[model samples]
Every structure is written in structure tokens, then in C-alpha cells.
Target: MRLQDLFINEDLSIKDAIRKLDETAKKILLVTEDKKLKGIITDGDIRRWILKNGDLNQSVSLVMNTSPKFVYEKDVIHAKEILKDKMIEAMPVLNDKEEVMDIIFWNERFSTKFNQQTLENPVVIMAGGKGTRLEPYTKIIPKPLIPIGDTPIVERIINRFNEYGCNEYYMTVNYKKNMIRAYFDDMEKSYSVDYVEEDKPLGTAGSLYLLKDQLKETFFVSNCDILIEGNYSDMMKYHKENNNKITLISSLVHYTVPYGVIVIDEDGSVKEMKEKPEYDYLVNTGMYILEPECLKDVPEDTFFHITDLINKYIDEGEKIGVYPVSESAWLDMGQFKEMENMMEKLGVK
Candidate 1:
């Protein structure tokens, strides 16, 4: 990755920076002023700034870390040393003119070696759907088959799971099942793939019942369109440590109301009035970790949503918990507009 490619102008709005970080799956953004490195802005910096009453309209310079440590062209050796010493994944490389250059990333250059390996978990992908929103395109191909660079969106998802030693996959297919299977079959992939078929168009979480016999251990389920970047091991640890029956991967979504009127008292007297109130809520990221036994509750041959299932669990006093992640950690590429916006944020041509 190149620093210039990842750089965000100092004048860029905080909202734009946030969007960029969310789309690129990057934790930090290099801030530049007049083609010169000014500072580095990290997700943490913006978060702290927001905590301190920073506005979204403010420029990234307001929160960027000035005097950032960087690597020069001739200092490649020192750069590697700096990366190791700092235990950083990547470092911004610069030229003699102090111009931003490429980035040196450890994972990009080295194969990850692990000891005391964790158990391989299975991932269930909800890939069936007409994707009526993406029309015409979905008419020819399924949503999971949509390309995000050169690879299909679902491929990227599976690869992400594979990175954490989750090689087994259960894919639920309905719309264009043959095309999806054919595509994967032609690829000759190493990972094992199991298919779950839906006799009819089952709503989200409805097709999961088809895998009741196949699921023996705790497993993960995710929508094909949403991409979540985080440590899967950490999520699994949280699930098992808490012994939760269902764990939902949630994102802290911030929504600002354009206008706010007034609050009236019981006596018909105006109590309080505020303008443009901002609210925070935990929005489902379409990812979940589920225990095998939970599948027994999923009714057969009926349209059931995951939300409905959660409500049922709650009514039955079953343990259901949410694992919250930063908004930037969740990437949604479902709609065409969001996809275009993602491409811009990722700096893709």
C-alpha cells in the first residue's frame, strides 16, 4: 500500500475521514497539507475528539497526531527496524523530499506463523436472495457473486474467515444456485464448502434450519454483503467465555436528527427544546455466533428472521448478548450507492 494512496487531505472533513477509515479497513490515515506530510489521524484520535465535543464539520487537522514518525527512502533498513521496535503492522514511507511514498507492511511481506493454533470453526454465509435492490445485475447473478476488485464479494468474505483458520463454509443458496455452485466449482478452491438449499425464498435466518444436522460446534453466520473487520478469535472468545446462546456482532451507529421540536410536560407546559439531537444505537451488522443447540428452536418450513428468533430467545429467557464494534469496523456493500461510496473511500479506481 502507498501512503499517497492512503493520504487524506488536512482540509478533509472528519466525516469523510471516518468514511475512509471504514471503507479501506484502515486504522490510520496520513494527513497531508500541500503535498507535505502534516500528521497522522487514527480512528482513536477521532473517537477521543468526538468524546471531547468535536464536531463532524471540523477538519482532520484538529485531531491528527502531529510530528508523526515516518520512514525515508534511504532509511528502508531503519524503517524495518522501526516497524519491529514499535510493533507496528505498517509504516508510512517517504522520499528525500519528504513526499509521501509507499507503505511497508509486515503481513504483506511475511507469512504469518502461529503456535498453539486455535480450533477451526465453520462459517455460515447467507448468500441467497434476489437482491431486488441491485436489480438487472442481480437478475443475471446473485449478490454474493458481485465483484469487489477482481474477486467475488463472497470470496473475499470466505478468505477473511480463512485467515482465522475457519476453513469450513456452509453457504445457503436459493436465487441462481446453479450459477453460484458452478462458479465455486470451477475455482477449485482448497476450503471445504457445504451447501444448504431452500425450497422457497426463505428470509434471513430461515435457511439456517437446513443445517441443523450439520452444525455440531459453535459456528459463525454472516450476510454475504456486509464485511466486518476485527479479530474473529476475540469474538469467539467473548462468546464462549460468556456462554451466550446467541452473540450478535453489532456496530455503534450514530444518527443525527435534522431537526428537533419541543418536549411538552403533562400539564401542557413546554419542558425542553433542543435542535438536531444526535443518538447512538447498536445496529446489527448481520453477523452472529451461534451454539449448535440454538438451531432446535428454528421452526421448519416457515419464514423466520433472525430478529424474530432473538425475540423468541428473549421471551424464553435465553441468553442473548451483543458484541459492539466501532462503526468503522463494519463495512456494508449491499446497495449500489453504498458500493460506489465504498470504492471512493477505498481509493479504488
Candidate 2:
């Protein structure tokens, strides 16, 4: 698509800009006013805006990059040089009047596919939860079998890792182990997966105890129903670079209070009164990277959550890192409502 195709008016709503970003498959858009370039906004910019609890109804100008990197139409060669130097995906080209003339893509300069190197670590999927929030659907088919498009949710989760060349998979199952096993057994896949059975319900990270000895290297643990939008390789790299015993993927979520909030003092006097307000918070996205040593601390059997493991490690002064991703990138399909929201955002009918 041309640069013009990705243009949004300066007054365009943040919500609409997001739609345009998804529709174009381009992570960015140029905000213009009467053919004049006002600024540029990328998916990352919108995510940061949301992280700051900005209103979705706000104008695109509120989050656009006013001083975005760009070069004149006469400086195309210089733009190419910049692209090469920065290793950026694309750079906008402007005419004498500062109007977007064209966009120079990385592929145009370097004729090679931008692929991320795959890591050969095992990905442990926690799929045993009885998706109580999904209700009647969970009653018929296992939560892992819940379809996100044509494929099951678990498959989508695994396929995402597959893109990064993560092959070995260790899935913990209990509620509907047979169905999950049969589903994978019938599939034709390039990767290998091993199912760890839990005789009883093992809370979140409990079933991982079964693979205690097998996983000696650093590995990943993810809930079957949640999907992350950031690069797994980058997160893994952060984990190793920081020497973290555990790395948790956190999603920035924006929550707005509908009603006016009042603060009262200890003596019951009204100290402050504020209208509806919004807040941004980092929510655990149920995705994590863990070192093998972390698994040893998990007791066999009994029930234990992954959070418990994190707390124990933190209390012992172990390093734990949090990699934040955009809210749009973290899809939680454990609940019917959240699944619907994710589907809508994905343009999945």
C-alpha cells in the first residue's frame, strides 16, 4: 500500500486509527490535514497512549509523532542511508511542503526477508484449566479445543511460537487430557509436543512439576488461552540478558472509572472529589520465561500457582523481569467476553 493509503486526518479518533493500522497491516499511519503532514502515529504510539490511560475518543494528534523521522523527496538516497543505518522498517518521504510523497520500506533497500532467529527452547503450555468462564462451550469441548478462527486456541498459541522456530512443546493437561491429546495426534505438524498428565487438578503451574528433570535449560510457560503480541525472541533475550530467574510478560491495560469518585478523610470528611477517571496498569498476561531452577522450587502434587513461584523467587532475591506489551497484543480467550473482544480486534468473523 502507498503512503497516502495509510493517511489519517489529524482529528481522527484513536479507535479509527487503530482500525486503519490493522486494515493496512502497516504498524503506522501518517496524520495529515489538507494534504499537509501533521505527524505520524504507529501501533506502538497508540499502545503507549493507552498505557498512559489516554481516552480512545481523543484525536490522533494527541498521540502522533510530531517530529517523526523523515526525509525530503529530493533526499531519497539519504533516506535509504538512514534506513540502512537505523535498521528501521520504513521511513516516510516528504515533498518541499512537508507533505507525504512516498514511503521507503526496509525491504526496498535490503532485499531479504526480515526473519527473527528461532530459539530451540521448550514451551510449556498450561492447558488444564476448566475454562469455567467459557461455560457451555467448555462443557462440550476442552478449552484448548476452543476455536479462535479455524484453528483451536492452543494451536494458535503454539503456531505463534512456531513462527519464532520454537519446536519442542510440553503441555500440561488434566481436565480433558484425552481430547487435547487426540486433537494433536491427528494434526500434521513440523514441531513435536509431549503431554504431561495431571492425575488431579494442578493449579496453573503445578503440572509443570512433571517435567522437572527433563527441562534443564531455560524454557517458557504460557497459559493456553492467552496470546501475546510482542516478540518472544526479544522477551527471551531480555530474560537472558537480565539474568532473570523468571520473566513475566505484562500487558498495559487502561481502565476508566464510570462514576465520580470521592475520597474521604479518617474523620469522615470529604477530602477530594473527582469526576470519572481512567488508570493504566500492567496486567500479567499469563506468559513467562523461566529457568529450570525455578521449577525445582515447585512442590510435587498439591496445588501451586505460578505467582507463588514468582513471589518465592523474589523473596529469595532472585532476579525477575517484566516485559510489557500492548493491550491489543494480549488476547485472553479464557472468558467468553474477552474472546469476543479479541475476535473483533482480529477481524475474525
Q: Which lDDT tens digits does candidate 1 get at residues 285-319?
A: 99999999888888898899988999999999999
User: Whole-model lDDT, candidate 1?
Assistant: 0.81
- TM-score versus the correct structure, for each prediction: 0.71, 0.81
- Model 2 / residue 223 / CA error / Å: 0.5
Q: Which 10 consecutive residues of model 2 have the lowest summed lDDT? A: 108-117
Q: Show where candidate 1 strays beyond 4 Å.
A: 1-119, 267-269
lDDT of each: 0.81, 0.84
For model 2, how does the per-residue alpha-carbon lDDT over 1-349 read when each residue is reduced to its tens digit? 6667988888898867876776686677888877777888886687667646677778898899998888888878786578766655778888998877888777666676555557899999998888989989999899999998787889989999988889999999988889999999998999999999899998988888889889989999999998887778878887898898998888766687999999999999999988998666779999999999877888999699999999988898989887767667788887888999877776685
Candidate 2 residue spans exceeding 4 A from truth: 1-85, 96-99, 105-112
TM-score for candidate 2: 0.81
